[model samples]
Target: MIDVAEHLAAVLEAARPLPAESHDVAAARGRVLRHPVRAAVDVPAFDSSAMDGFALRFADVTAVPATFRVVADLPAGTDLDPTLDTAEAARIMTGAPVPTDATAVVPFEDTERGLAGGLDPVTVVAAPRAPGAHIRRRGSDVSAGDLVVDAGVRLTAAWIGAIAASGVGTVSVSRTARVAVVSTGSELVSPGAPMRRGQIPESNSVLLAGLAEESGAEIVLRTSVPDEGDGPRRAIAAAEEAGADVVVFSGGVSAGAYEVVKNTLGDLMRFDRVRMQPGKPQGFGVTPRGTLLFGLPGNPVSAAVSFELFVRPALRALEGDAEVGRTSTRVALAGGWRARPEKTQYVPVSLDRTDPAAWVARPTERGPRGLGAADGLAVLPPRESDVAPDELVTVALW
Candidate 1:
């Protein structure tokens, strides 16, 4: 038997980041960058108007009730560069390039006529705007060749937009891991199928596949095999042929009789009883072809817990993520619960956010109902039999 930390460390030690590949920036969300992304061009490449207004020298509008001649009309995307002199203004739309001599912009609302009819000589009803007002200066947000995003950043929608604004069309990011989920059991049947007295609908594949996908892994193959004959080996071979980087097997890892995974790949894998509740039985090893293998318990909750505690971090490590673990925070317990002695317990819990700074965790309803309502798992350390109300506990958020 090994401790949870030891097992996790072993798993991480065996996993390495996948090779970097160039991908379109539009499709790189949820992927980690292998190298820093530098801006190819400055944001707001040229000085532009931030609002639809009149562009003129601030000196010309220092006094209210002043009149200025409209020299030209500048709309967005115009290439013509008009110059502004004293008492002269240009009707400029938002995002239009500002004139070289213009030092201020007065919004249409601050002037007479408001450009409602047409660009004509307008009277300034408000005081002059400070110099350089309402102008988005060139390279203000990001200069050309500046670091737009650092390496190991998990690309999000905002990051993609920033990259695009910096004139980056493509990015080099860590490749997503290819995963294969194999559920083993002869008595297992697919969902929505008729079941006999001893047969049950298989759900570990769907559960594991969804979890894997959430962790940024691409599911290449998902299949179920019986416990008898060469079913398990055949499925593993199919996974290898499909170019999988990792193969996850659900069930048949315990000391029970007729354990298919233990019987088939026992020699090739290292099985261990981790000191954790719900998911104590675990197995992991790397194949000769360099594909990682994981054998998780069959029970739905146990399988999900094992995936979060072990497989998810490994997947993240393979993608070169700096933060590979679930987010956790300390919260007060709303109720009391019994914990297993000498073994860690991961109890499902729901949060009370009436006070965000002091969140309270209440144990969720037991059985399958609990799984649905749980927002996080309250981690109970070993040797703590009972918890009191309002006790502080660390919760790993989903």
Candidate 2:
């Protein structure tokens, strides 16, 4: 039997990222980028007004009570000729293009309406204002040919806004991998259903499905099987028929009298009893239809932890993400603890960083077999026992 870390390496080594597919920028949120995204054109595109004010020459005004005749009115998206001189002031609205020779903008509220008698009323206002105060310079935000986003970055809301503002209406991202989840147990009943004596509700299927989704895999099929070998085999057959790249089964892989999943899949799939606690029993092999199959433990906590520490990374690898693996951190044990020398122990523990550089690890009351209500798993090294308080221990973070 291999160690926990070595087992994970073997599983991750078997997966690969899916191919890239073109999708609309609006629909690509949360998906991984498959190619670099370059700016389509100048972000600002043209020199325009940033405020609803009068566009005029910076040198035209001397002091307060300075006046200029409004030559032309320009609203947003309006195109104007570049023929304005120092004597000309254009009435520009916000987002409107600035006419040539304009260096400042005087807001309309700053000026008062002049006499409306027979002449074109000249608005009186203060001037000799600061340059570039209200003008949005062309290419100020981004140039015409700048790279906006690079490949391997996950698309976020801000990225969507940036790509759209850069004139990119579509984006290319990695396609999501399709997955199927199957649960096997005769003692399990659906939630809210009346249970017989000694029966438990089914939960591993839903948990695995959620885990798969978090790892960027799409769940296309979900089903449950009885604790009979024929029932589990039928579920696997159905999962393959649904065209799943990966098929996950829960609850029938452990060592027990009624381990139907192991018995059924062992004939058509490879079975391996791992050396880790809570999830020591496991199996994996290719389905008859060529889909990857994983038989997870039956206990809720064991199944959940095993998927996070093992199966989730494989799904991430199949989604074009390079950072695909469990993250481990060194933590100081809060209390003294001991473990067996041969079997790898996954103890549930709560961690805190009271000091910036040190992590405090507090072991939970739950044992390795009792993982359903655990906070997270702590990897106990196989070479030692009786870890002291404040001793450094490596733990896998969720």
* Candidate number with greatest lDDT: 1
Error of 1 at 392 (Å): 2.7
lDDT of each: 0.90, 0.77
Error of 1 at 66 (Å): 2.0
Query: For every model shown, what is its TM-score relative to the native structure?
Result: 0.94, 0.78
Q: Scored by Cα lDDT, where does model 2 land?
A: 0.77
Give the clashing residue pairs of candidate 2, or none.
Answer: 251-298
Compute the lDDT of residue 171 as modeled in candidate 1: 96
What is the model-wide C-alpha lDDT for candidate 1? 0.90
lDDT tens readout by residue for model 2, 1-398: 77777777767766766778999999999888888899888868888888776788877765667667667878898987455665667777889888868888777666665222112434647663588767888889988679898887778899988999999999888888889998887888897899989898788888899889877788989888887659877776677777678888887777788888887777766667677877887777765555767888887777877887778877777777656766788888787577667777777777776778877877766533444444456787675557777788888776
